[model samples]
Every structure is written in structure tokens, then in C-alpha cells.
Target: MTPSIMSLFMNSAFLAMEAQQVVWLRMMRVAAGGASADRELSRMATEKMQAAIQLGTAATLAAVGGNSSERIAANAIRGYRSRVRANRRRLTK
Candidate 1:
């Protein structure tokens, strides 16, 4: 069950990466028109990459069982919940 859950998370992460990449590529097309646009796109891409890395790391930690699997899974769940809440807040705003 844990492995299956981890796989689902991993797949979702990959989808997020693909979506981010598509957005970044589209941004790059517009970025070519101005220096400021280029800079902003670069910053956005960097932020997205950092978020992907953080999510991937958390998933990896949760997958590798040890004395801390329970703790890691709990932390991952908390992170997921926080993200959901943040998205809801953004949508409401």
C-alpha cells in the first residue's frame, strides 16, 4: 500500500514537472521580446524547479523506509495538505 501511494505521488510529481516545463517554454517565447520578461521568466522557472526538487526529495524520503518512514509520511501528508490549503486561498483571493 505504501509503495502504491508513493508511486501515485511520484507520477503526480512527474506530471507537475511536465506542466511546469510547458509553462516555462511558453514563457520563454514571450521572454524573447524583452529583457525584463526574460528575467521574470527565469525567476519563475527557478522557483518552479526548486519546488519540484523539494517535492521530489520529500517523496524520495518517504519511499526509503527506515526508522523514520512513519515520520516522513506524516510530514509528506502535512505538506500536501498545506499546498491544498494554499491553492484554495489563492483561488478565493
Candidate 2:
């Protein structure tokens, strides 16, 4: 499959996993109870949410097949190699 399509699939999977984790955390917080417990749970949930967002962004980038610089560099290298090969062939003839 194309890189773009593959990226979309990976991003979707990552998001699904994140959703499950959020649900699990919410359930745990509800089970804990009490004002103090609620405060702690809120803190923990906020931290987890931040981390999940960071990770999700990374996953999205990976799914998107990363930055264009790498692809551009590779294409440049391929073109240069092809040119060199053609020059060598001409010199030989």
C-alpha cells in the first residue's frame, strides 16, 4: 500500500488505543472515591491526558509518513546516482 494510506491506518489504531486507555483511567478514578482521592485522580488523569496527546501527535506524524525532507533527499540522491550512471555509460561508449 502507499505510504499515505499506511499512515492513516496506523494513526487510527493509535487513536483507538488512546481512547481505551482514557476509559480505563476514568473507571479507576470513579472507583477511588473521596475528595482527596478525587484530587489525586484528577492530577493523574491530567498527566496521562497530556502524555497521551504528545504520544498521539507523534503517532499521527509517523502515520503521515513523516516529514517531506527525507523523501526529497532520497529523490535527490537517486537522481544524482542515475546521472552518474548515465555519464559513465556515455564515457564507456
TM-scores, each model vs. reference: 0.37, 0.34
lDDT digits (tens) for residues 1-93 of candidate 1 = 243566657655755665555565556555566865676567657755776788669778667745256556556655654554443343234
| Model 1: how far residue 28 lies from native, Å | 7.5
Task: Report model 1's TM-score to 2 decimal places.
Answer: 0.37
What number of clashing residue pairs does each candidate have, in the order they appear?
A: 0, 1
Give residue 2's lDDT in candidate 2 (0 to 100).
Answer: 32
Specify the highest-TM-score model's number: 1
